[model samples]
Target: MYTALLHQYQLVMSSREAVFNYLDTLKPEDLLKPVASFNNESIGSLMIHSADTYTSWLVNFARQESRPFYTADNYKDLASIRATFEQINLIVNDFLNHFKDVLDAPLTLPKKEGMELTLSPMQLFTHVITHEFHHKGQIMNMSRQLGYTPVDTDVIRF
Candidate 1:
C-alpha cells in the first residue's frame, strides 16, 4: 500500500511541477497580485499556504516536530517558492518513510483545550494532497483573472 501510495504521490508531484513551470514564467509582481474575489490571496500566498499545510500536518502534527510555518513574504518569487517546495518534498519523504508500516494506525491529535482528533497517517496524507489540489485550482483561477491562461495541472495529462 505504501509503495502504491508513493507512486501516486510521484505522479502528483509531476503534475505539480507542471504548475510550477508555468508559474516560473510569471513575474514576481504578478505572483503577488492580490485577487479581490479570492479574499486578497495571491498565487504565491496560496502556494505557501499549501506548503504550510503539508508541514503543519506531516511534520508538526504527525511527527511531533516543531517545523515553523512559512509566510507569503518568505516566497516572493517562483524560485523561492520552488525552494520551499523542495524542503516540503524532503519532509514528505521523511513522513512516508516513518509511517510506511503504520499508515492506518490511528493518531490522537490535540485540538484546543480538552479536545482531540483521531486520524490516521493515510488520512492526513490524503487531506494535504487534496488541500493542495483545491488551492491549485484557486491559483489557476486567480491567474486567469490576472490575464493569464492556466495550463492544465491535472495528474492525468491528456
Candidate 2:
C-alpha cells in the first residue's frame, strides 16, 4: 500500500544508492585528491558536504535540532560516511513512516536574512535529493581531474 509520497521517498533513496555504488569503485585515496578547479573542493569534501546538507535541511531542521556540521575527523573515510548516512536513513525513514498521513504537513524552515519558508515534507525531500546530485557532479568531475575514472554516476536509473 505504498502511497505516491512513499514512492517518492523510495526513489530518492534509490538514487543515492546508485551514486554511492559509483563512489565505491574508486581507490580510497582517490577520495582525497584535489580537484583541478578554482573551488578547491575535493571528492571527499564534496561528498561530506552533500551528506551534511541532507542532515541539515532534512533531519536537523525538520526535527528542530541544532547540530554541528560534519568534519573530516568525524567522517574520515568511505565507511564512516556510509555509517553516518545510514543513521540519516534511519531518521528519514522514521519521519516518513509516522508522517505518511501528513506528507502535506507544512514545515517552517528558517533561512538567512531573517526569512522563514513553509514547505511540505515532499518539497523538502525533493530539495535534499536534488542538492545531493548537484554535489555528486562536483565529486565526479573532481575524480576525473584526479586521473581516476569512476563508474558513471549520471542517469538516475532507479
Candidate 3:
C-alpha cells in the first residue's frame, strides 16, 4: 500500500508538472482569449477552476476532521483563480513531502454531495490526481478549439 501510494503521488506530481509547463507557455493575452466550447471562457479561467477545485478538496480534507467532503464555490475573477492555483500547487507539494505523517491516517471525505465517508490516505491521493487529469482533458480540448497547440502529457507519452 505504501509503495502504491508513493507511485500515485509521483504520477500526480508529474502530471501537474506537465500541465504547468503547458500553462507557462501561454502569453498573457492567451490566458484571456476566449475558447469556443467553454462558453467562451478564457484558458486562465479553466486553469483557475481546476486548481480551485483541487485546493478546496484538500482544504476540506484537512479542516473538517470528521466531515466527509466539501466542494468549492465557483471562481469569479482572475486574481482569485490564480491564487487558488498557486495555493493548490503549494498545498499538494506540502502534502506529498509529508506523506509519512498521514500515510496511515483514515480520512473522512465527502462523497457525491455532503455525505461523509471514510477513505485511506492513498485513496484520497489517487482521487486528487485522477480529478486533475479529468480537468486536463477539458482544457486540452478547449486549447485545440482555440487554435492553440495543446501539450501532450498523456501517461503513455512519458
User: RMSD in angstroms, all models?
Assistant: 1.0, 2.7, 5.1
Candidate 3 clash pair list: 68-109, 68-110, 68-116, 69-109, 69-110
Q: Go through the candidates in order and give each one's C-alpha lDDT.
A: 0.90, 0.72, 0.64
Instruction: Please estimate how well model 2 matches the true structure, expressed as its whole-model Cα lDDT.
Output: 0.72
lDDT of 2 by residue, 1-158 (tens): 22765676567667667767877887888776666682776677787787788778766777677767888864566788777778767766776776677667898878679999888777777787788878877676777787767565554652
1-158: candidate 1 lDDT, tens digit per residue? 88988897898799899999888877769999889999998899999999999999999899888989997656788888988989889988888989999999999978678899888999999999999999999999999999899998999877
- Lowest summed-lDDT stretch of 10 residues in model 2? 149-158
Judged by lDDT, which candidate is best? 1
Off by over 4 Å in 2: 1-3, 154-158
lDDT of 3 by residue, 1-158 (tens): 55565676566667766766776676656666787678888666676656655555555564443422222332344444445656666766666555556766777666667798887555666677777788789877776776679878776563
TM accuracy, model 2: 0.81
Could you give me the TM-score of model 3 versus the true structure?
0.65
Worst 10 residues of 1 by lDDT: 71-80
